[model samples]
Target: MRNSDPTLPPGAPPAAGAYTVPRTDPATPDGVGAVPGPSAAPDRVHAVASPPLVTHRECPAPHVLPGCAQSDGLSPASRYGELFVDVQHSGLFADSKTFPDCIPNCDPELIVTRYREQRATPGFSLADFVQAHFTRASVPESHYVSDPASTLHAHIESLWPVLTRKPMAHPPRSSLLPLPHRYVVPGGRFGELYYWDSYFTMLGLAGSGCGDLLLEMVQNFAYLLDTYGLVPNGTRNYYLSRSQPPVFILMVDLLEREQVARAIDFLPQLRREYAFWMDGAQGLRPGHAHRRAICLADGVVLNRYWDDRCCPREEAFLEDMQTAMYSGRPHHAVFRDLRAAAESGWDFSSRWLDTPAAAQPANLGTIRTTAMLPVDLNALLWHLETRLAELCDQAGDADAGDYRAAAQRRKEAIMQTMWDDAAGAFVDYDWCRGEPRRCLTAATVMPLFLGLAQPAQAQAVAQAIAARLLDQGGLATTELTSGQQWDHPNGWAPMQWLAVRGLARYGHDTLAREIAQRWLATVASLYTHECKLVEKYRIEPCGEHAKGGGGGEYPLQDGFGWTNAVASALMALYGDVAATCRVDVGDADSGGQPGHPLS
Candidate 1:
């Protein structure tokens, strides 16, 4: 069926053949389109019917320019311009010229080439270069040229030219390839990674002017939705069973801002992606309390990370191993363990073992359930639902109103069930025990990101976070003394960025600035020391005796993707923090007293 309405947005290209929109009556029973409420509707949800698929070109080889022709009349600026001209012109011709023949013996190329080649040759020393470059001459007493501080500054100023002269070579822009695997767990031995996490990481990339990479990531997710019903936790065959949080709607928003037509081209994919998340609850369990169209028992929604095919429970490890082969060439065992750790999210808990009450045998086989629905996951899904409803409305779909209503209902359910009055923060429920887990993990602050917390609640959570979980650098994933790596004394880049943004959103400028500055400094310090972004950092002070430990089925892991991406985004945000800090600070500032129930 064809959509007769020309104003309706085009859907995703048809599965195998030409793309077509399924026709539905605008005024029929199945067409319950929601009216736009007071909130201003987006101008146009779908921008283009179909955008051309992206294409990549191979990077051209570097062209070596002929040495500059030395002329006595040429000034330094003119000489530099001449060199640049030569470099540009070299691309037209393939022949090479010797340095001395093309230019004078004192040509800059001679200096550069000699320096690099000498550095590359074994034992061809830089000791003489360092001494000559840094040493200062002693000034006579009458010269007035050597005030100690002034002299130091002068020396630094002089070094700048020499330092800048040796141009650092950047990787050919094209050679800096995107990771073939979208989501990478540097320490997670699992070869495949997750979907939603990649979306957040891609956001950081988009903000950093890596729009091409961001587009690739979005296309990847769209491909997954088209090929499979939904994107699984990762691309690996083993990860087909479960998914992480839903953030594809946010990804579409990013793409739309980049170019509207691009998003419209992918609308059908977006619709199906939403369908996958809403599948189980689409009238299947209408009696559920949280009448958001999707329902999970006990008001909990969203799936925890699971890899049913390969992840082994304690009781079935031997049996599972016999059938499930490990991905070959394991460079890091810790990463494999980390991947397994994601499965239960109860890092190091003994409950995963096959105790009578702990283990349950199901269709996938025997597995243990930690039975906690994370607050952050649900909050993210709620955000997705709202965005989806807006998309539907913009597309002129009749069911848009129902989606909006459902989202509002879910938001209310989340606030009622997850917000802990005694804890003064949002907490995840341990479903088995029917109680909130009072641990102070960074997930507690996620409600602020979702705008789920009230002004007072936001303030209390921020203050409590600063008091208990925050360190000199950033908020720890958990309280440091907890012994669980994921729990405490460890600070992750994503969580730190989230907290900084969350606090800023609530008008905690002073606290937010401190956290942002500390984390940025730590990241900068690490980058300076290592010349690379790392996955995670140990913010805990070292004890007299260095402790070696294990958590969950694996050792603590680091050098993560979400970490690097978040750190880069945070650094970018640092420039504008002071200006935006005052936007959200309000009457809640007074609510942040010391004893305000942060659990």
Candidate 2:
């Protein structure tokens, strides 16, 4: 099982500081290894066999003088090389994307020392050092800056040009973390392609006649799947240990309109992605579990969000350290919560809290996300399975039979395990307690969105949403006021889209349209005041919370990608002559027609 040679194959260790993905053979049966069997520990860990050892002592940049005094303990790459991470945690650099890349051919310590020395000298400013040593990623001012004149449609149209990243160079350099094909980034703090965010962004691109970009993004995802076994959370080395929600199947479905014939071409990658999620699934037996999979008392298998590395996130390093310090729990347990939160994409929600007493509610150490079968995660996998079966049927692949059978079993397990008969909703299942979490969040609508709910079930879910979750502005993430971005009063773009679409699917168009209109109006109101779209909004009646929908690590960000895209889509669907009249201008020069019906 062990090999000294670095290049033997993936799953075997590579050179000390290199990364290798465990590739699965497409033609082989049991291509991806199964989850451990009944005797294995239920809380077993599954991680990269040998992750690259990134340390300050072994700096990759060659400019550091060997045996120099500064080289004794300093890692420039750790401190200054990743400007994105530094600025995010710094609180000094307010704008995430406006910072310069690392200064080439210079030691980080020497640069910092010299910059300080220059500042002490007469008339010497930080800008002088920046001019001498660094280059800006782009001219932020030349690009569209937020302004009062900008409408949501205008901002979105402007973003298509600014956020679209071109393909990377061939035989990508070792230092490069870029993807091989063009893709759009969520704006402001996020300057790279994200896994789940891309799908929502594509919806706007497709509706706006930018289907070409949609195809290119899908091509990028395929490239990642082929190269890395699974797409990293983002196109970054730090994100390799875990992935966000699997939305590649949905991305492929969105692009099928233009390339329907090539739809089956993505099946191989789709199968591999499924294998990654279900890596431990096949070995499940009664009363046993493994990474990402577990067995219920009745022997049904289900999924949960998991991360291989149980540690603090690199981007929010200091915040995580402080949280762990105050958590009064073992460091290992805190790490699991942090990683599980990342996998959920609701990094710090009350949905993950383990106990009612728990010493304190905000104590992140109480997070038990790994011990719960998330409703949204399972529903997403169900969609993927259903899609795989359809594509297999089209291509006449023999795997069609297996996929259809898997989809059916998953649908049955979801209904039996997640359904809350009295609550009239689908709730996240706590594997430890063997009962529903009963949060009544926006995730309940996921089954409806996927068309997996019976008519009665869908009706109940809709009623639950209206009764507990929905507000005047739109749907809240959950009923709690935990000061987390994913909790109450902080309605997000993706959740709103899910709730609206899910309601519409179950013959509740009137309610769906009402929610959509209200959300769109909220967006308009926020834009009118701030002159920019944001990541999340205070969807409560404005006076409920102290600062309104604010929480999480940072302040509300603008140049928002998903918000603009989702708003554009909803406005197109619901905007009438009266709504169109509300727009400041008839149309803008950038091919932006704010009130025009989507083609």
Candidate 3:
């Protein structure tokens, strides 16, 4: 079998202890490699070297080698995190539920010694050493069926215990700070409290009357903001460099609606999170960029997704390394690709790439995520700012003025920078290229969702979406069929929800109901066959047999958090297909209307 990096010399062996992928069917997923040779087994291989000695430069931040003056003692969980990165070099855990828990339970030095001894013994295997010295937690079983009538509700109820985890055991602290309470994970391979996913999961939780769990999840996010300065994408140390979407404000807003008294309590965290996204805003001058916010040519600051670190992500270390090798770009640029993708929360989507659809072989290096100010992210921030202003008003605090002014500036900036008047839709601004990206994406509806768009603009956006973006399944993420999961033929629950609500806000009732019904039917039809809700759906309505949504770095995942939440919310709001179709979707309530004064 050939080595993983095609760029290497024809017969050159892989780097010491690097993952050596055996040849496999080209059609398979990127992370799934061919089985390794016996002597090059995963258990025997370290992440980057034969013995994998920890160097001051290579260790995860805050835990450089002991000799380094700034280094701190590596916690047991972090040690396990590093080990998990090493022992599972062949992407063993990339698609597994228990992979997240593959943290270190034994001494790192002893494990390294055992690895060396095993490699020295001609017939010995490193897998045997892992069996003797390490332990992995089992995935909790499910008690649901494929019957559509009851399956969705059944899985939501039954998976509570399966999805919920107690605080980390003491001996091995979680790579992250321990959670204050039990929380529901999104299940499948995602075994942590993902930032954006949790908000949607709470929808199902709230629908099922799991209010305590909902509150606990919000508290957990609050805890994250207090400790990490920003919520890491998920509750893992490795995800610390970036966050998913800034959905914490929405989560807290939901809590406020449910239990009005809690609103004031969460205000401080909301402000802190806003500060995290706008970290470098105060210093921004014309035509410069800061962490997440960029000053446009017009001197209006807008936001884009970015990560602080420019290195291979720990969880997808091997995949990122291989992508870098094939990218024909510098290592840091590829790292930016991976990080920027994470920031967008649509990892590996062509929406972030600079190349055209005709560009062959997926040059991920063309990804310029830091240089594109996405419409959805800015709209979400506008929502956050609006909400903060409301909270300040309710509490009689003067900061409401500041938040309102911030929101107004962002709203005007979005209108000026994102709206494509000729196309009658919003588009992402390629700051690096100084032009609108020209691709229409579901992200355009975000302004409508957050009540940021003016009435005429909202109507134009709705027309553009219905004319070119809507599909049989509901809504394609983008108008292009780029083989990336976030593009054509695929529709995700969150976008469906936002687009549906956004349309309704503008009194596009018939269109809004049509979208909601189509999405619900897709979910129902799939449930009848698969009996499970997946992370994404094939909504293109081609004559092909329905299969799992394909593309992206991983397989279609079930135990989907946002899917359940959005479906549950839609089901509650618009019940059966007949009723949903008949319902008149008018303007959203006065509070939900767009173009209202900030908050």
Largest lDDT belongs to which candidate? 3
Q: Tens digit of lDDT per residue, candidate 2, span 1-599?
A: 11111112322321221111212212111112232212322132111121441211111332222232221121122334333233333444433223422223355456556654565688864545555765444324223466668766776777787778775321121222556567887765566678898888888888788877888899888876765567667765556556789988888877776453366779988987888787766767765666667777777778888766544455454455445544555544565567668878886688887534533344455677777898889989988888898998999888888888888888899988899989999989887777888677888988877777887887777777777887767778998766667887788889888877777776776667667876777777776665667788887777422123686765566666788789888877787321222222111011111121111
Model 3, position 170, has a per-residue lDDT of 20
Model 3, 123-145: lDDT tens digits are 86556666677566544333234
Candidate 2 weakest ten by summed lDDT? 585-594
Model 1 spans > 4 angstroms off: 1-193, 258-265, 282-370, 480-483, 543-560, 575-599
Better of 2 and 3 by lDDT: 3
Better of 1 and 2 by lDDT: 2
Write down the lDDT of every candidate, Cα atoms only: 0.44, 0.64, 0.66
Query: Which residue pairs show backbone clashes in model 3?
Result: 80-103, 80-104, 473-539
In candidate 2, how many clashes are counted?
Answer: 1
TM-score of candidate 1 versus the correct structure, residues matched by position = 0.55
Q: How far is 255's C-alpha from truth in model 1 (Å)?
A: 2.6
Sequence-dependent TM-score of model 2: 0.76
